[model samples]
Target: MTNSTRCGECILPDSLPGVNLDKDGTCNYCRDFARKEDRNPHLSADERLRRLERLVAPYRKRGREYDCLVPVSGGKDSMLVLYAACRLLHLRVLAYNFDNGFQSARARENIQAAVKTLGVDLITYKPNEKLLDQLFKLFLTRTGEFCTPCNLIIQAAAYRIASQNGIPLILSGGSSRVFGGIQGVSQSKYADRAYFKNVLQGHVDFREAKRFVVENPWKRAVRRYTRTGPNLVDVLDYVYPGLEQTRDLLEKELGWRPTSDELEHGDCVLNPLKDYLQNRKWGYSEVTQSYSSLVRTKQMTREEALDHAEEEETRQPPAVLESFLNRIGMSREEFEQTKHRHFTEFPNYPQSRWYRMGKKAVALMRKVV
Candidate 1:
């Protein structure tokens, strides 16, 4: 494996696809941040609160059910979202937890604590474990990521819940602007419907694929026409008070506790396995992107980010790894084989050259317009 080279200004490494370093060793991401800063200064806390209040005012107590649906994984970020929705904005919230049966004990504790303390109704959803296991095994053997199924199911459930409950707003913790930089090369591969179908076709039978992997087309069509879908709002975009400020607030007000493991992935047992494989293949993991975000935002120094990155990227919890492998019915020997497989060998699902170029063009247009 080639040694990774990082941006001089931030921790975004050269190993990431589409990251280019200029003569100063600063990456394109840094330049983009600079340009964005010049065009739009950061919003103050008061301004953020005002904007949030305005956004939530129309939907507050609109129905008998709930004002907003906040997806919480018991992470600090999601906790902050719940806090703001309940304590600050005074919006009635329904906390949704999409459990894949890999939730950490601390995470579960935090989730229960947050909902109980905040007096928000809580709902937990888990997909069929047998089908979920088959899906994870398929993704692990076919591509490098097993989180694909989890992400897809989470979104689908969120959409379904919001539509069924008539919830107008779905508030999430963070956004691409916050953690997009450090994502590994595997992100470039498309994991849309076509990609999932192709992968399932190669392994599972048509009935199993239809039942487990595919979303109901008729339901989706009904949602589209009825305007029952909830509008997603990333709370960070409006009210990010930096990592330290958030942690302090959560601790003092909500009795929040940090997990014993790395705070980057919260309480998911499968995250370490995913990070390990990504680091093995691409020379970076979720830690890089997260700390890189902090560096770019000036919440953390590049040196400190580098130190944290080194520790997180190289370390994997043994117990979590073992549990994840056993759950997916894969042996450590099979996991080791994945290290030799490159990301490019997998089918690029949603991302074509033209698609990437179009995204770039759209971003540029948004900035200029």
Candidate 2:
């Protein structure tokens, strides 16, 4: 298993959990997508732009101080979303960020540069230091991974701020075709707020983590059923130009640069730690998964993906993983014992009703969308 058997059509490797290659060497994921490919009719660039305009116009007419909320992590994707919210759509934009205390300094610099250059108001939210460390330790013990809470809570915080301020939209720069799951299927990674609630209910007090979390399952259901909340839109599905074209645009627009190697997971300081742990637990690399996604979409050739996969696999685990353990009061030995554990390994993981419902809701949304 030193090297993974990859799909012929895409870079997806058989090492990914649940990935299977047929005799023809095409992975199940590629086959599944082929069956559903026609579900999404290819929209012309012009028509996509037109759809975007109509979608945001009603939100813009609500007479809010800011027409939309864009979460900026100082990554090119989020920065581009901020750029589009301001320069492309000519909307008054507000930017939101949450620092879990592990974000890279380069990312911080990019955020400042983007907000200053774009002339948008910004909010930086930080969770309570003591409780955050506790959650980190808890997650590592339960799940081999620890990035889920950050993903969920950031969106939760965004929704909270949007609800309080009457902001009508949240535009995230996410694309399903980019850096998708290793199995080539996009599934939530125990990262929804409902899962956050499932993790925290008996362990951490609601009042203690009040500033950083919100867990109202009934309200969430109502909002979903009524469809009466700030419409969160992924700008990539609508306005994406291309990879190089976006990079070039951000460089010219906000003096942005890739913070990491080949624009993989440069946004977070702990990304290398993530790669190391997940590779050990799941027998795959995030870099390979992303490159495979590029190959899957025909954005990059298989030869190119293979070359980068080899290069990416040679990367050593970063020094930050050890320091991160120290910060969370975990010794190297404790980490070694715990790092391979998956969330599902715990007794009654994801036991909450809403979290189960939320997972189904994600699948349903994908079908109609």
Candidate 2 lDDT tens digits, 251-284: 8889888878765467888887877776665556
Task: Show where candidate 1 strays beyond 4 Å.
Answer: 176-178, 181-190, 205-226, 315-317, 340-369
Residue 365 of candidate 1: its Cα lDDT? 72
lDDT of 1 by residue, 1-369 (tens): 547688999888888777789999999978988998899977788998899889878787644688889988887888888998998888878889989998888889988888888988988999889988988887787766687777667766776676678888888876544565342354423455545666677577756545333354444445556855677788877887777787888888888888544344657877677777777766777778778778888888889888888877845435577777888899888877766655345544334576567657766977999
lDDT of candidates 1 onward, in order: 0.74, 0.76
Report residue 127 deviation for candidate 2 (angstroms): 1.1
| Candidate 1 residue-pair clash tally | 3
Which pairs clash inside model 2?
A: none
Q: Name the top lDDT candidate.
A: 2
Clashes of each: 3, 0
Measured on C-alpha atoms, candidate 1 has an lDDT of: 0.74
Q: How close is candidate 2 to the true structure, as a TM-score?
A: 0.88
Report the C-alpha displacement of residue 82, candidate 1, in angstroms: 0.9
